[model samples]
Target: MTQAQTLDHTSDQSIEHRIGTAVNQNAAHTREGLLERLFGWFFKGLVYAQIWEDPVADMNALQITEQDDLVCIASGGCNVMSYLMAQPASITAVDLSPAHVALNKLKVAAPRYLDQNAFYDLFGHANKDSNIRALDQHVLPHLDQITRAYWNKATWRGQRKQMFARGLYRHGLLGQFLKFAHALCWAGGVKFDKLLTAQSLDDQNAFFDQEIAPLYDSRFVRFLANRRASLFGLGIPPAQYDKLAADTGGDIIAVLRERTRKLFCDFPIHDNYFAWQAANRGYKSDGTGPVPPYLEAQNFETLRACVDRVEVLNQSVTEMLAAQPEGSKSVYVLLDAQDWMNDDQLNDLWHQITRTARPGARVLFRTGGLTDILPGRVEGAILNHWRYDAEASTRATAEDRSAIYGAVHMYRYEGA
Candidate 1:
């Protein structure tokens, strides 16, 4: 079957089956190591409703234009919506997780139909009671049947719609992980919320120095940081775990401490939503806080106008690109998914990427390690077709406000 046909034929059962297949595929390529297996299992259960990477850095590196057709891995669906503001010709958002596919569809569809306040309440002020009601009245009727079914499915707490009522950010894998981190901080007498009170960069640095940095020194924190399972919260697969350790001289604690410090101290808290989410366990409750670019009121009308340009699919990126016509896409956002792949997988993906990309197409991605993996791993023949923009990549990495990833890499396809 054609790639689009295969994706279109994926019933809800098939999507679940695909998730299982993907987990197995990831595990099978990783030598079936115990930690790899554990990570694969963890990934299968993870529902990433919010993306962690900085989309602003991604867009800056991509230099997206109205003529560019883009394909991105839809994680939390945040960046997919954010990308709409750039007015790309088309955005094909593919994800193996059915939950993410549904969420992305919901995001794209919500803006098209819902009024401003209702849309904000559903996604921005996710803790509010009206979110579920808004989802029902304004959003559900507009979604495709599969997406609607996915959202309406029951969870342990209640229907998935109730997730917004309970606070959408508190439900996903990353969200729950942050919640656990906050719980740990509270137990240890460190108030993560206090980091939000810092009025300046120096104050933020001092807050981290006095309150957050010391938490990493505790035996309990050190022990947790050392465990592979502990990092599943951050969506670190077993392979990425090894890369992170190797990059940090096997000192995961030190690496995490440094990254956490950068997150808190390097950016102004007023505009760094990532730090706010990490510290406060959600976006600022007042709705005036820093948020994803799409959620900002200024971009709402533009995003709403561009909603129809996006397509959400439950499929793999390689498959989606393989199905496209040559020179079909100009921008690719891999979002650290490459770190999970073996060399063969990477080569296969790059092969399809090169085939589908137009000349001057820009590819943006992050890595668990500071070094470039593509140079040695992807076949030289395929790698030669793309020029790695090392200087731009370095600038993008340094400017990335999220400050969690080890490096951000960008490449420009030079054509056949």
Candidate 2:
């Protein structure tokens, strides 16, 4: 090769070093002992209960356009399907879990094919007979083998296929974990029935002072708070668990109560379904409202067709970036995935993102800290190209429901 060719190859290697490939990636957490892995999975079952991440908020922050081709992580497939509402050109949903992939596929295929009423009945009135009927008559036959097995064959407590057989919407690994917490609180004499009854600000404040406050000061809640394994259900990592726990510093229940209070006090309880699921274990019945297309009224066909335009795979953001056709994609929705990354991962992910970004392409993600993700973590070369919307990010942070994250950020990839 000539001198010019050698210089070109050297520069390519440098770029790869800065934006590492998937081959350089490791599991987000190092390989833990078998017991740790088991515990982590168990915690994942609990903490991930009911997809705690806010899809509606994500949609709003992303401001997706129909011309955009979206690549995103499929946590529960909620956001992926929801993204379709924006009429994006295409969506690629990737997940690490087979179960998540299966769930996303079912969501994409089932809703569009089933009757709109049946679609709402299934996802909206979840855990009801109408939902069960919809599943049996319209959805069951259509589900892929893995999803069908997840519904009809997976056994827990010898109750095989109960999530579907019993119309249990909140009974997935996450849902069951939540129910476990409820059982724990009930057994420990924390009256959840009374705690959930705050009709107004006055009622909420009174309940907080009279009943919930006492529980926050309780011995049981404190014990539960210390068990790092107990919080795994919420998808908190070991490091994050330390931060979350330390954020309390002393009284776990009080700190926890304050965090939960944001969902109730700042935002209307009725509007934040995440709060509803946390407080009430389910959303109020109107059925179609506030849900993705699959769960919307008279919109199942739109959702089914929309699903066809979406592809769900088990891959990381870096891997997605590597395989993307150059200049083919116009948007990337990270969705707080970066909050889970260490600096190395963040740098590599951004490197690939910059390479694939088309002019004016937008990138949006949420963070756990008040400052944006760019300052300390993102390198100078890529950071220089992207303009940070500090004002917008700040405004969004004050309104964020996931109290732990610092801010939600949006950026457009500008050329060097």
Best by lDDT: 1
Q: How accurate is candidate 2 locally (lDDT)?
A: 0.62
Candidate 1: list runs displaced more than 4 Å.
1-32
The candidate maximizing TM-score is: 1
TM-score of each predicted structure versus truth: 0.93, 0.80
RMSD of each: 3.5, 8.6
Q: What lDDT is obtained when candidate 1 is compared to the true structure? A: 0.84
Which residues of candidate 2, in runs, are more than 4 Å off?
1-36, 43-49, 129-133, 143-146, 157-161, 167-169, 187-199, 245-255, 285-294, 298-301, 401-406
Per residue, candidate 1 scores C-alpha lDDT tens digits across 112-202 of 7788878888888788778888888878988887678767878788888888988888887888788889888888788765678878899
Candidate 2 lDDT, tens digit per residue, 1-416?
A: 99767864775454334223222234435642332454444432312324555656666666778888888877677678777777789998876555566567666777656766666555565656565566666676887654665555545454333454353446666576577766765665655445445466665556556655566666776787766566656655444444444544544455567766666566654355665565556655555224443355555555666677898875677877888776777778776667556788788888888888777777777754334656778888777878776665665566666554545787877774
